[model samples]
Target: MLSLNSSAMYTGASALSALAAALLGTGTFWPIGLLYEAANVLVAIIAAAAIRERGAAGH
Candidate 1:
């Protein structure tokens, strides 16, 4: 369940970032793009940690 939840969260964040980047265009307004990218990375890290904890608990 945790795995599925994390995957969904990661996927949603990625899709949102991509959509924002496409709509905003990544030129002079690169800070917003960078912010989205950073958010994606943060989400990935959090999901990974959750998955890892879930795995460890089964052992």
Candidate 2:
């Protein structure tokens, strides 16, 4: 099911963002923390856009 797969991907992306936030809040790994946070945000935005497009298409 494409919808199911898309939902999983969106959920995974959100999890990544949450994990990055947790790591950043912990105040450790300064350099890598910034990188992960940026990556998470990017992934989340892309995932959200994909989900939106799928929804618009009636998927």
Candidate 3:
């Protein structure tokens, strides 16, 4: 749940950063956008691990 929440937040942030970059025509937002994307990937990995653990425990 926490992972999912974080993923959602990071995804939102990334989208906003992209929009800002597009509007401002600056490369500055690119790095922030990349960072957010990386965070989202990490959160997704954590969520997958948690789900796998839960499934294993259930069986």
In what order do the candidates fall by lDDT, top score first?
A: 2, 1, 3
Supply candidate 2's per-residue lDDT for 36.
Answer: 70
Q: Which pairs clash inside model 2?
A: none
Candidate 3, 1-51: lDDT as tens digits: 999989988998789777666756764656666766887898899999999
> After best superposition, candidate 1 residue 40: deviation in angstroms?
0.3
Positional deviation of residue 19's Cα in model 3 after best superposition, in angstroms = 19
The residue-by-residue lDDT of candidate 1 on 2-58, one tens digit each, is 999999989987887787777677455677767768877997998999999999999
Off by over 4 Å in 3: 1-27
Worst 10 residues of 2 by lDDT: 29-38
**Clashes, model 1:** 0
Best by TM-score: 3
lDDT of candidate model 2 versus the reference = 0.83
- Cα error of candidate 2 at position 53, Å: 0.2
lDDT of each: 0.82, 0.83, 0.81
Sorted by TM-score (best first), the order is 3, 1, 2
**Model 1, global lDDT:** 0.82
